[model samples]
Target chain A: MELYLIIILVLMILGSIYSLNASDLLSAVISYGIVGFGLVIAFLLLQAPDLAIVQVVVEVATLIIMIAAIKNTQSKIPKMEFKPKIAIYYAITLIAALVFILIFDRATGCLSQFGADTMRMAQPYIDGAQHTKSANLVTGVVFDYRAYDTLGEATVLFTAVIGVLTILRIKGKKEK
Target chain B: MIIYILCFILFLVGLYGVVSKRNLIKIIIGIAIMEYSINLFFIMIGYIEGGTAPIITKGFEHSKFVDPLPQAMILTSIVIGLATTALLLAVAIRLYQKYGTFDINKIKDLKG
Candidate 1:
């Protein structure tokens, strides 16, 4: 399983790099789907079937929307302007990434190794979940244990839809 | 732990795209990539080597369950990511309609 995950993770990185460097917008979006689908698989491998399902569904919708967006405007990516500023930006990003990883590695030294969750907070969920009587613990957690979180999620989705409609509106101002 | 570093590298790839890309759609793709990495990291964090799914069944009620808290949190994050992506695309389309191009470099007047 680890071998398979390593291969998938490497492929996902390749896909991300290709999407960023692709000249064609449609193909770039397609490669982005590769990253997303790879993610769905990773979720499944990690024993999070619920996440895999949600991710797969969302990935398809996102790909379709992105493809539609590119179709509406242009499919050809504009040639990147070569500039000294861009080189500096690259240097800065690379340095920042290195610094970040170093700090993160040092900071997480006290962290437990993978697959050994301390269950500091999750133990209660695991113990109390049986009372909820939901076979699927994830569903129980989402619906019963964290109802307010679900409500917030719904509100966010509603707000985003409204925002999209407003932004795409044909008319924003009244006629004078 | 090494896998976690790899995941963070994926995130760096996304960050690089957002910082360097001139196209709006590419930036959105980068943002999506970043979101995926974060979600994957969360799920990976909650993973147990020998644990089964968190579902409590008839006989497996006493079995080990992977952390359910992160799964629930990531569930919401995924939906929110979709909304974020949609809103971003709509904005990109609107920007195209108004400017007649997807290149941010051409939209110079709005920069100031």
Candidate 2:
């Protein structure tokens, strides 16, 4: 299982790198899809089928939205000229990323090991899920224990849809 | 674990794309990639060895289940990601309509 997870992680990393470096927007988007699928597999391997389902659906929708946006525009990225200053910027970013990673590693070193049954906060929810009469523990947590947060999430999605409509709608009056 | 480190590297790659890329759509894709990496990391944190899915069935007796809190949280995050991606695409399309090009450098009318 660990080996499978490692392989999936490597594939995801490769997909991200390819998407970032692709010369055309379409190829980049395709590679991004690869990364998304890799993530779905990883979620399954981690025993989070609920997340896998949601992620797969969301990824498909995101890809469709992106493709629609790109269909009417230029899809090719203009070639970039390499500059000495750009190299310096890359070096700086690399050093900063390394330092950030080291700090994160050190900070999380005291946490419980992977797949260890040491999550105290979740124990209550797991034990009480039966009383909630929900077959899926995740559903119980999302809809019962944390229903208010879900309501807020629904509100956020509604607001985003309204904002998108307002931004993309064509105005009747043209100033030109 | 190595998984966590790899996830962070994926995030950094996405950050590089967002910072260095001049195209608006590519930047959106980078943001999406970063979002995926974070979601994956959260799910990984909740994994338990020898654990089954959090769904309870009638016939099976299971003592161990993966943490469901992160799964629920990630579900909400994924939906939010979809909404944000849709909104960003709408904005990108609008930008294209106004500027006639997707290159950020050339679409600098507001530059002082």
Candidate 3:
């Protein structure tokens, strides 16, 4: 399964590169659409069904918005040519990111090795908590150990809504 | 695992697009790619080898089930991603209306 996913990832990367190089707007859009769908499948294989579903939905919405934008703004911007040797730049950045992640994952694995410890500590609490009955450990974590965080998250969303309203200035406008 | 490395590569590809692509739509796609990569990473963390789903059935035992916590976390994250994508799309649309173009390179009014 992992090997298959790796192959798919490689193919997706190649497809993205091809899309990047394709001069046609429609092909680029199609490539992005394919990538979006591929990501949804990858998310499910990685055990994130909820994310997969939501991502697919959001991606469809984004594709629609992008198509609309492209229809309105149809021409490429004529500016300094993209002659920064993108291949070299991407290769270097990819290596740097991979090294960083590897070092961090390895170093964190060495330091304290507290993942199991944290789980062990939380185990009794988790088992004892009535909230676990909700069938969502994340919700338990959210509303129990970190109820304050949940409140803050809710506040952030509320603030975002207000911000959107302020920006729209649609005081009497019908809700969409 | 190889899966993880590939996911990281996918993430790098997306990040590269985000940094190098000047088109607004491409940048948005890049961001969406990054979002999916993270979601994939989170889910991978909870995967158990040969482990069954957490659903409890009449004949099922609890010992073989994989951890359910990450699944729940992913559920919340997915919803958050939805909200983010919606907000960003709204912003992108407004940007198009304001500037009449999706070329970030041409947007010079906000430059410092």
* Best-fitting candidate, scored by DockQ: 2
Model 3: colliding residue pairs: none
What interface RMSD do all candidates show, one decimal each? 1.0, 1.0, 4.5
- The second chain of candidate 2 has a TM-score of 0.94
- Could you give the CAPRI-style class of model 3? acceptable
Model 2, span A1-176: residue lDDT tens? 98898898899889888888889888888899999999999998998888888888998998898888888667878677899998999899989999989988998898787777866778898888778989899999999999999999999999999999999888746778
For model 1, how does the per-residue alpha-carbon lDDT over A1-176 read when each residue is reduced to its tens digit?
67777788999999999999999998899999999999988988888999899999999999999888878665776676799988997798779999988887887777778788567888877777768878888888899989999999999999999999999999779879
Report how far residue A105 has shifted in candidate 1, in Å.
Answer: 1.3
Off by over 4 Å in 3: A18-29, A75-132, A135-176, B109-112
lDDT tens string, model 1, B1-112? 7887888889999998998788889899999999999988888888887788898778988888888889999999999999999999999998888888888888766655
Clashing pairs in 2: none
RMSD of 2: 1.8
TM-score of chain B of each: 0.94, 0.94, 0.89
Model 1, position B32, has a per-residue lDDT of 92
Q: Write the per-residue lDDT of candidate 2 for residues B1-112, one digit (tens) a residue.
A: 8778888888888888899888888899899989999998888888889989999897644668888898999899999999998999899998898888777887886445
TM-score of each: 0.93, 0.95, 0.72
> Clashing pairs in model 1?
none
List chain A TM-scores, every candidate, in order. 0.89, 0.93, 0.58
